[model samples]
Target: MTAIGIYGSAGRMGRAIATIVETEGADVAGGVDAGGDPTALAHDADVLVDFSTPAALESHLAAAVAARTPIVIGTTGLNATHHALIDRAAGSVAVLQTGNTSLGVTLLSILVREAAQRLGPEWDIEIVEMHHRHKVDAPSGTALLLGESAAQGRGTTLGEERVDSRAGLVGARTEGTIGFASLRGGSVVGDHMVVFAGEGERIELGHRGEDRTIFARGAVKAAMWLADKPAGRYGMTEVLGL
Candidate 1:
């Protein structure tokens, strides 16, 4: 049986992970919240799952490394520094990270990439995402991941051509630009849509997550999968064999 340690165990996603681990016949070694010690918790488990905030990422990664435990991270809102830290830690332990853990969302990203590649630069791409009102990030990490997939298919970098949104007095939409729009409202689990618009036709690829447990299940799956792999960095695409 897999031994699991959960970080941010008090939060919504954390609790969901804990529930899934318990129900799946896996061992819940221990957990750590904001007020607890992750290093101590990690020491008792084979793999650590993190659904915490960006502020806690560094410490969590450090704890996992010190304990020589694998980690599956589902937290979003990462910047260059976080990527750097993950890369550093991957040298010592297996690490899997994903912006969205739903299997459907991962498939949606692949479809978005295919559409971008087939439609060419003439068709503009836009990503729209929504989450619960309590979400702190403006554009959900899932939206950015979808945007990156589209940008990659077009052979360009996301940063070079991202249009977050348009406001009053905005001019015509820019060609070859990928736009992102975010919405937050009452208890929305998660929603993402990638729109491709051209002269005569439009195509939309989307995914809707009705429950947080989809993510929790995926994270646990990732933790179990990463436990046997050699030290390296991985994503949900690898986890799902996309």
Candidate 2:
């Protein structure tokens, strides 16, 4: 059985992963919260799952590299610098990172990409997402992930033509650009929808996460799949064989 360690163990996502470790037929190697030692837990665990804050990413990834343990990162709000760090760490240990760990969202991304590819640039692309009231990120990572999919289909990148917000006097929507809108309220777990608007018809692909358990389950499934794999980066599509 795999031994899994939890970074930010006391947080909502960490605890959610903990609750399913046994159900995954894996042992909880240990857990570490803010200010705790991740290197120690990494040394003891066969696989590490980090749902910690962006501030803790460097240390957690370094720990995974030092211990040569596979790690699955579900933490959101990562920037380019964080991605560079993960890229470096992947040279030493297997790493899987995602905005959302729900399988449904993973598949939805594929559908969004395909839709965008089938539709022409005349079909404007827009992405919208909503999370729980306590969520702190604008344009939730999952939204960005879906936007990336649409951009991929359009032969461009999200950074090239992404629009997060607009106020009065914002000009006409740019062709081939991907727009994003974010909402936070209530206890909504997660909701994402990608729209491709054409002349007469519009195509929308979406996913709703009703509970955190789905993410936890996907993380566990990813952790187990990652264990004993070659050093590299991976995504949920690989875990789901999509």
Candidate 3:
């Protein structure tokens, strides 16, 4: 069996992945947390799953590339710099990164894209997402992923027409622009809804993550699928065949 490693082993996500990995009869080479050596852990495992912090992303990717070990990145709050790093690392090792790893969210993205395509520009796209109170980032990564899907379906790039927030008597919603709203409170694992509002009606597509276990399961599955793949970047859609 493939040996798996966890980068944020002491955290909730790391523990969850480890628990499920054991239950699935898989081998855990080791895990790394704050102050731990990721390069050492990467060297010992066949694959790595990172639920660690953005500050550690560079070191983690370097370690993965050096060890030639594939990695699944489930960390959120990443920026362009982080993505640039992932893109570079993918040249040396297989790297699968996603905002949300749940299979349902993967399919939800596909459906959101299709809906955006089928509907005309008359339909205004708005995405709302909510996460746990402890969550740091606004407009969770999954929300952006769905926004990307919506943009792709409309044959436009998200950066071209994406609005992250609204305040102070904002003007009317721009046509063809994707709007995002974020809510953080309680212990909501995750919840997302894509609303397509037209003149006479509206269509809403959504997904609710009741627990972190779903993300952990998907990360493990993605890690397994990535273990033997060639050097490149990947997503949950490839893992779930969505």
Q: Which has the better TM-score: candidate 1, or candidate 3?
A: 3
Q: Write the per-residue lDDT of candidate 2 for residues 90-195, one digit (tens) a residue.
A: 9999999999888899999999889888886999998989988999988998999999999998889999989987789999998989999998999999999898
Candidate 2 Cα deviation (angstroms), residue 14: 0.7
Evaluate residue 223 in candidate 1 and report its C-alpha lDDT on the 0 to 100 scale.
88
**Which runs in model 1 stand beyond 4 Å of their true positions?**
none
lDDT of 3 by residue, 24-116 (tens): 557899999989889899999999999999999999999999999999999999999999999999999999999888989999999999999
Error of 2 at 185 (Å): 0.3
Top-TM-score candidate index? 2
Candidate No. with top lDDT: 3
- Descending-TM-score candidate ranking: 2, 3, 1
On a 0 to 100 scale, what is the lDDT of residue 104 in model 1? 81
Q: What is the TM-score of each candidate against the true structure?
A: 0.97, 0.98, 0.98
* Poorly placed runs, candidate 2 (over 4 Å): none
lDDT digits (tens) for residues 50-86 of candidate 1: 9889999999999999989999888999998998999
Lowest-sum lDDT 10-residue window in model 1: 22-31
lDDT of 2: 0.92
For candidate 2, the TM-score is 0.98
Indicate whether candidate 2 or candidate 3 has the larger TM-score.
2
